[model samples]
Target: MPELTGWAWALLALAAVVVGLSKTAVPGAGTIAVAIFAAVLPARQSTGVLLLLLILADLFAVAMYRRHADWKALVRLAPAVVVGVLLGVVFLWFADDVWVKRTIGVILLGVIAITLLRRRLQAGAGADTGSHRIAAATYGSLGGFTTMVANAAGPVMSMYFLAARFEVKAFLGTAAWFFAIVNVFKVPFSIGLGIITVPGLLIDLVLAPLVIVAAFFGRWLADRMPQQLFEKLVIVFTIVGAVYLLVS
Candidate 1:
């Protein structure tokens, strides 16, 4: 089997928890998922397998929060995201395994910095923006590109939702449905790219059930937290995730 070592399995399990938590509570801390996979698997292969895990997590999230999603935002973001996916596929052709790892790290750090800056600005002031269409187009492209290349979609869309001032549940619910839909669509692309192999699938079989469990736990916690605190915690963890990537 194309299995990770014992330590790698442990890391993967922990990373799976991050995936669940991201969907249910944080909406952006999924670089842990990318980090664990890239650390254990070939960089390119990690992207494929992580995409599968993300889809599984996404399914659980959608099931738990289908009622909380904002369909208008989802529809607004889809077209630009599709274009970004194509761009990512093009980049994949040129990038090797190591470059993918470096690229993912760099992007994560940038996202972290931007998120912090956004938070600071919002605390003192706020950025002026023209229209929802503009934000949707920009975020959609970034989400599609990052998710395709590195399974890093969570942060991109997350920033948008945060800026939009969504209540906690709405943010998570919308993110849940959004990622679930995107992840499901990623399957054919991952297979066509030869990222998901027999051994990889076997490994995933072992890890997948844990995703379900964590999502349930995350849902319970998210339900309990007040909106203000949940978003604050999300920002804090996003900073932590960024730093982890930068140092790793």
Candidate 2:
């Protein structure tokens, strides 16, 4: 394992708990974990390390919300997401750490803008139009790219599900399974790129239990949270995360 300082370890522990909560309670909150991990580790290495922790959280999310997923949404997103992942791999092939960090920051801000605009439009129209194929492709592709590059897909997909007008349970369920599969698919690519390493896995082993505990806590919290409060929290956290990425 890397010889992290006490403060670094503490931050990573917090990040792990945030990952669990994000998986089960507030989706966009995971971006905060991304920011924390990136601050403490090498940018690329952080992505690999975070991916493993995220998958662990995803498992708990799946266990809790497995039956609520929308298969139609998942099916529509698969192809576009795959394409986006391939593009992200290509970007990683040549971009340096600075580029990767800046690109992710930019993407986060852009996604937030688009999401906000879509919400306004939906309000005016009195309905969500996110069921269209083009909307799905756009969000899916962006979700894939951001997740591959920075493990920052939580906000992007959260926006999509919100725009699609999913109820709280359905949103969490779909996101849980979507990321569970997507994160698993990313493992080999990360390994091939020399991103996921033994030391990172060692770190994950120490933090895994925290993630599991937080997942259950998140599930309990989500069950009681009002839908309006939940959506507001997602947007708020996403904006905070985007700003942190840009300035940090």
Candidate 3:
């Protein structure tokens, strides 16, 4: 382990719980975890640790929502996502710690903006007239880049699924599968970039159980929490986290 203080461990545990919740219930809130991890650890090491935790949570999400995924959507996104991941790898190749931190902050703010836009558009009729092919390519590539760079692709992908007008379970299910596959695909690249390391793996072992428990808790909370309230809270926290990352 990296000899983090008690406070850092607490923050990491909280972020782990949030990751589990975002996986099973709140779709876009994982960005908050991204911010927390980034703020507490080195920018690059934070990405590696969070990626492993997310993959662990992904297993639970897939088990819970696997049957509901829309295979067509996954197929549509694969090619563009691959392109974006490659671009992200190139970016990581050249980016130093400060650049990675600033980029993540910018991406986090952009995610918030996208989520708000998604809500506003969802309130109106005929908000999805864009071609499905174009939409898929655009969102897939963006999602891939963000996920690779900062593990902050939830809101971007959420916007895409919402624009597609997926029902709740379908949205969660498709997202579950989408990330499960993508995150796995990212492992080798992350390793090649030297972000995924033994210290990060040690931290993941400590936090993995929290993710498992919280994922189940999220499933229970999903039905009870008011949607409007959930969205508002997530946006507020994400903004705070994003700003902290930018100026820290």
lDDT scores of the candidates, listed in order? 0.78, 0.90, 0.84
Clashes of 1: 0
Predicted structure 2: lDDT: 0.90
The alpha-carbon deviation from the true structure for residue 50 of candidate 2, after best TM-score superposition, in angstroms, is 0.9
Ranking by TM-score: 2, 1, 3
Residue-by-residue lDDT tens digits, candidate 2, 1-248? 79999999999999999999999999999999998998999887888899999999999999999999999999999999999999999999999877776787788788778878877776856554444687789999989998898898888888889878788999999999999999999999999999998989999999999999999999999999999999899888878877777777
| Tens-place lDDT digits, model 3, residues 109-154 | 7766765676676576555435677778988998898889888788
Candidate 1 per-residue C-alpha lDDT over 1-248 given as tens digits, one digit per residue, 9 for 90 to 100: 76457898898888878877777777777877777888888876777777877888888888888998999989989998898888888888898766655665676567656655666766766555555777788778878887888887776777778867789878988888888878877778878888877777777788888888888889888878987787777666656655665576
Q: What TM-score, over all chains together, does every model reach?
A: 0.88, 0.95, 0.87
RMSD of each: 2.5, 1.5, 2.6
Q: Which number leads on TM-score?
A: 2
Tell me the spans in candidate 1 whose CA falls farther than 4 Å from its real position: 102-129
Q: Which candidate, 1 or 2, would have the higher TM-score against the true structure?
A: 2
